[model samples]
Target: MISPRVNTRVWQRSISLLSPQAAKTESNVVTKERTYIENLSKDIATSRFRLVDENGKIASITVQPDIPICIKKDCLVSIHNLNHLSLSYKWLNFWSNLIKFRSFKSSLFHRIIGSSVLEILAAPNFQTSRRPFDSSRSLSVLNLTGTKDWNVFGKDSIIAFEQNSSLEIKSPIFPSARSLVSNSSKSQLPRKFQILNGRGNVLVCGGGLVYSIELIDESDKILVNSRNILAINGQ
Candidate 1:
């Protein structure tokens, strides 16, 4: 299969954060109502998927059978041709307004939200958009068939990824800040880097252009910030 090409606009000098008014207008936040899965897939060619573009154009990619992708449950537009898809709770936040998991690894202490499935009339496109950042970069899907691992990304960086995968948190977050905070403070918060393991595909929006750096082995670790990451597989 051919690799998909995504169109990118030149980077802006400064980006504006979402305004309260704009946040209020989004249907994703205002409504908990979901579209029928069968209905979403039924007319997927021209209907169902909604991009962040003002023109309402939709982009789509196909997922091979049993290949589970990770996505913010809210960003999911539609999925088709597969059954037996499962959901595992990733994490929850009482501190921030943004809750980051539609599918996340289980943690014992987080608050659990009740679940429901979003589907449409037909096959659905796994659609997503940039949030709390560059909201215009509508959708970007990376096929993991040829690659082994990906970079660690911000919590919001992923829209959807392969379900078979797992994520691990890395340590010693930043060099300069290591001395700034006490070791006890470090234990209180979440770890710095998250490693994604397992197989199948991962779909991500890196906010601007998405780049993949191929690593040949375990010792080849890339020292980078977590926010800049998209996804990674293997140790």
Candidate 2:
């Protein structure tokens, strides 16, 4: 005859060994990491310029007509100009851009249509290539604070910028005249670099991936290929 306490202990042990334990579930757990493009969208959600799509191949930018935006004529996809916005063309570096860049697309200019929402898309022809690291073609947005100037490479890559902002086409500054003459023969050197200023947003199209890097100070310098560079802070 087993004692009552012994039987209770045996039963408890058997139950503990037979039953499965409940898993602790967390309600606040994040299963996936958000992409950088999503983060970029959030940062400028309140601004007039919004990044609609930037999925490595095709990139799109949506613009609200609070202010006029200058866009490349070729990149214009659609516009809502029921009566609010207006469209016009202006010559920007027409002859120089045509000769230097060997492309007539950048020579022509198109302005935002009246009181309209604009959609601009850029789909580089080589986007389908099987290159492992092809971040050269993509789209990026720059939020200008009216403080420092910015230098934009490949004027053709410039899809649009706020009309209130100022863009000046200038030649690249060399350390000295000798360096400029020596590199004149180099086909890789950009014939012109567009200097951007004022407070607004700039939409730039790159060859592959569009990303940003911050240099904390003068000590935090980085070397990147000129061809791959889209924009740089003039400071």
Candidate 3:
């Protein structure tokens, strides 16, 4: 059996906005908000986390971490199941090294790099919103209008982000005004792109090179060989 990672407490002092608020779940959530949700095929090997839909048909979900659930119905695959190196989020970088010691406590395998290996950060960005995201399951909320998505916020996922993986702050440019498109299509991924807000853009963070994002807007260009890109906030 694969040896599981150890339990590490995630620090939340950086984001005080989430203190008075809580993560949401499946219920009557997503009222007047543009919500996103991607179905799952199997449970991913996440250490421990929750899911919350800001724009959902439901208000809140109830499942917690460490409690495995058996599939009772036919499963469907997602973009995350395809194992495409093209759609990868590079989180390891120079700046991350600065805070590596700060995150040592919340991680499992901190310094191992391999094709089959996945590294979990000791500190995942916190997603804070007006109503507060409901992290009942594996859903995460990144409030863009708020300080959440504007800067680094929300826990980074080991898997690709979807509606089931994370939430993004609606930009003043579109979406919230119903004028933009949701970047969940697989064809949008570049030869090298990082997972961010379930969308694909030419990631330039961590001092990487700029490259084409492929099959979409030219600005969607992502940087090559960089995974520190947690999400793409711009178009």
Candidate 4:
């Protein structure tokens, strides 16, 4: 997705240099070189772009119109055409305590301002960073075309997703039996499982180093510990 376009002039010059007899005379080569430089300047002026890297993790994307992208909170290094983009919190689970906490803060902020709703944007000089431990966790960038509908994920696994994608709490099975079997050593166990459902580009933060395995069939199913699941790709 981030491959740079090749410059044809480089190849042309190399071919000319390699030929014993002049493929292009010195005067012709100089003319072509000047023309190439002029064209390169035009391309840069009309289609300029930049790569943003923070904490040595590079997010290379060309700023374009109407392309929806999801970036994790505190991960953005820089952006262009700020006026053309919109930002909002992508609700993952309304029932989760994290959402509840955020809602409470938002409400209090709005009440102080005497507004029904409040939206905030970063100031031009504002800055943020991921903790060292957090940065150690791998980030996975996925390109989805809306073909797969079902995705099961563990709690806190999703870092960010496009606005159009929908995520809801999913309980794959009743946890009563699971609790009895898995929680014998502990006093209690969580009685539910949470999953995200959507189709779009998503960034998932794994607990640690993350690896993926393909599920060939029902018989090949591998039970991943809940904490280790970063994202599920298909139905």
Candidate 5:
């Protein structure tokens, strides 16, 4: 018996977000017009399970801390709107979007939009930040408010916004994305810092703010209370 690498995966990710619900066109299984919706609002905590449909690119979803866990297998999972509904099933591998049981409340940017933002899918890694990661830094993580509401992300993942929300990444290139991943809690204060994985090609504003993102593989993720962030160096 062997084990997989810490953050490594064994399959190609079919996609980032969950797939659309399609009705079973065959007679071998139950058939129904699948409706989409967000079943819960709190946090999600569960175990790791695999799905056959999604090619294993970044599969393997784990819900350790249960704040807004979904119903057991074969149950109705209710969400606020159909659009918020992303992942659903008795088992899932990668949590492309917000679909966990554990949730940490954040009022800092709440009510500013249609809904409160949750978890944050951290952008590429940046050098240790140069600006003070506090209330001022909070504005950095607020991606554009287009058709994509920021509250959905807020509910699923925690932005590096809280103070002390730092972690030791596997490479120096990662921590460099600090400014891009900044939050009131965790941030790389050194404006002199550099951007690691520059597929994003991001730059810090005079006030330490950014208005764009390139998007890349920001996979190996974590969410500790910003206050728990200690020092981040070569891990």
Candidate 6:
């Protein structure tokens, strides 16, 4: 019987022929990916709110009249009102109105109003986290329909709201005698709450990432620390 010899050279040749094609395919994929990333970065740069860093952190926000924004007075980098949008403010307290701290009564302002565009930037030192209101994530956006009510813990964190929205500063509800005596921590007690309701969006600034959790039914209940609360839906 004659033994047939295997052609090792043929196998080597076949592999050599396929290597360049695989390398070219990989290079094409990498080039396409890089192009996509560049295009996405350009789009974000031209967007209304542009993130300053690669980490999706926004350093400045552009305000449009149709979508007004409220921000802390200290966080204001610059205000350009070329369109002459209505700029107004609400007093956090009677004293705040009378004193006019920082030439404005309150710490927050409605930076945009009417049919024009406005541009504003966050201060470099400003470090508060900004996120859209999401109930499931324990976040709250102020939207008042006049039918529902929101109890905001403090006025300082409120950034902005719709032009039509209304805010009522109310004294904190008195704690029960038992709570007063048993609760040693004064911070746990209610101090003041801003009753907010209206027909537009409200921007709130939180110390950290804003999140919210919703209660589905009457049986669903959770006790949250008062200091950590941003806002509560009174509905």
| Candidate achieving the largest TM-score | 2
| TM-score: the better of candidates 3 and 6 | 6
Q: Whole-model lDDT, candidate 4?
A: 0.37
- Against the true structure, what is each candidate's TM-score? 0.35, 0.59, 0.21, 0.44, 0.15, 0.48
How many residue pairs clash (N, CA or C atoms closer than 3 angstroms) in each of the candidate models, in the order given?
A: 31, 15, 37, 0, 67, 10
Clashes of 1: 31
Misplaced by over 4 Å in model 4 are 1-58, 61-64, 67-70, 87-92, 97-134, 145-147, 150-155, 165-194, 221-223, 233-235
Deviation of model 5 at 40, angstroms: 14
Candidate 5 deviant stretches above 4 angstroms: 1-135, 140-168, 173-207, 213-235
Candidate 2 vs 3: which has more lDDT: 2
Q: Each candidate's root-mean-square deviation in Å?
A: 15.4, 17.9, 20.1, 17.4, 20.3, 19.3
Q: Kindly indicate the candidate among 3 and 5 with the higher lDDT.
A: 3
**Residue 186: error of model 6 in Å?**
16
Cα lDDT of model 3 overall?
A: 0.24
User: In candidate 2, what are the lDDT values of residues 91-192, reduced to their tens digit?
Assistant: 666666676677777756677644556554544433234552244555566666555777777757676665652434343333122211223443243435
lDDT of each: 0.35, 0.53, 0.24, 0.37, 0.22, 0.45
Q: Distance (Å) between predicted and true CA of 171, model 4?
A: 9.4
By lDDT, who's the top model here?
Answer: 2
What's the ranking of the predictions by TM-score, best on top?
2, 6, 4, 1, 3, 5
Q: What value does the lDDT take at residue 133 in candidate 5?
A: 28
Q: Write the per-residue lDDT of candidate 5 for residues 96-175, one digit (tens) a residue.
A: 11123222121111110112222322221112233222312211212111112121122212322211112110112122
Global Cα lDDT for candidate 5: 0.22
- lDDT at position 158, candidate 1: 45
Name the candidate, 2 or 4, with the larger lDDT value: 2
Between prediction 4 and prediction 6, the one with superior TM-score is 6
Candidate 2 lDDT (Cα, whole model)?
Answer: 0.53
